[model samples]
Target chain A: MAKLKNPRGLEDSQVMKMSYWKILSILLLVYTVTGGFLMEVPRLAIVNETIRSLYFHVPMWFGMVVMFLTSTLYAVRYLKKPGAYFDIISVEFANTGLIFGFLGIVTGMIWANYTWGTPWHGDPKQNGAAVALLIYCAYFVLRGSLENSEQRARLSAVYNIFAFAAMIPLIFIIPRLTSSMHPGSGGNPGFNTYDLDRNMRMVFYPAVIGWILLGVWIATVRIRLRNIEDKILELEYEKNH
Target chain B: MKRIISIAASLGITFTGYAQEPEMADGMRSEGKIYVVVAILAVILFGLVAYLISIDRKVTKLEQRLNDGKPR
Candidate 1:
């Protein structure tokens, strides 16, 4: 039996061992079981009511933040290494991050509609998130418009770094300056004191971990698929030439 | 055309009647629209889950093909 070589020169066994999805599935299973049990308990109903969205929404934001941070790291590494693999990883992570970001927005809107008056109030947090999303959207558009791979990677990396730097102030800092209907508003305590209790933390922490792992898992799968597609395209081009 | 006009005329009168003194029940009726919104969102969520499952299967097939060294 012969082993196939990965394009990056890693062995097939190594690739098989790198299954983030399997780990994520296990984490998700644990979360579902625990969350279900927690919801059923009558004593924690008050804590669980509004905080339930925290499990879904906070995890999404955590995943998005992690993805963007990881992509930034990869972008920097790509600039240093000048490799296609890093570029692919960065791009795939960005794409996955955007998916989670969009989910976060949807979940936040639904929660807000129930808690606030409207689905979308002109809140600073909402506007900041929208801007951050648009910046990432432009990053993809910039990549699409570029003809050369190296140029695309370079320009996109630069843009990724800038967008991420801007995102920090937009999503986190600037939102803190304004009066927001959402939690963690101006001069208000955030996720501290009475906001998050022990019971809520139990599920909330795990939810963050589970969702971040899931995001990474999804990004890894996307990266693998993209790598394969690139290899196939290269092979076809070689054959044609 | 005349029948359509009469129907429109009657609807217009009915709307004017309600518009003059929009009853408190109309508030409840508008609030009921939230249920419709929730239902639509539920349907969308179901559709998204279904689509995601399909995508997962496709990805599995693609991965298997890649492992087998088949062109796709």
Candidate 2:
């Protein structure tokens, strides 16, 4: 790649870091929006055209899970080696994950309302997802209540790992163990049974990647903001002392 | 007359239950309105991406300033 100079004088490292993945994210999403609609889909009775939502709605959950997984890995890294940067990265990833989770729930509800005949069916997956989100919500609460920075980071990193562990069962395992209106649960036919056509897979996989990349992109931006804030605080402390 | 009308409506519902083809937005797609929907959503997605990129650039600029020890 040619080293392009920016008028704003951003270093090559910073400029190049965001170059390829960002462009890929945009392109994949644009393709998702177009292909997701126009592509051939399995025609089922209740789902009907709403099967198209699989492209948009399911990706939110996939993105959320990926974000949370990334957050947890960073949290573990923070535990292994205490550092402000790792803490910031962990927190930002979890924050982005929470946003994706919220979007997933809202979109799920909308899809459920049309197909399942009610917004909240007390379905296992629905309740599981809600509980998982609340667990993560408490993580932020825990972080907010702590007064010391080191203690806050250490405690919250632990809590983040716990939250991710709890989320896996709540969203994935528990839902599958019982009856669920959600596909692939309680012996219900899943996407593989009918809807996972080659055409749909083409758009679906890209959508998942695109959404996950977008979430990571947002998390990285927030991490940068936190770093800047930390630097300013450090500079101020040094000057005062 | 009311009884006859109720019977007809019930029969219609029953027939719909056994309808051969599932209902879909074929009319909308055929009329090209689905493209309109896709276009609007694409525009919104692009707009958000652009905003995020701008923020990313601004953050890079701030980082540069801080690295130079010239924090504005």
Predicted model with the maximum lDDT: 2
lDDT of 2 by residue, A1-241 (tens): 7766676655576754667888999999999999999888876556778888888888999999999999999999999999999999999999999999999999999999986679999999999999999999999999999999999999999999999999988888887788676875654435543344888888989999999999999999999999999999998999999
TM-score of chain B of each: 0.46, 0.72
Cα-based lDDT for every prediction = 0.72, 0.86
RMSD of 2: 5.8
Q: In model 1 chain A, which range of ten residues has the least summed lDDT?
A: A40-49
- Candidate 2 per-residue C-alpha lDDT over B1-72 given as tens digits, one digit per residue, 9 for 90 to 100: 233334434554554586666667889989999999999999999899989998997888888889976536
Instruction: Identify the runs in model 2 with alpha carbons over 4 angstroms from their true place.
Output: A1-17, A187-190, B1-18
Give stretches of model 1 more than 4 Å off.
Answer: A1-21, A29-37, A40-48, A193-195, B1-72
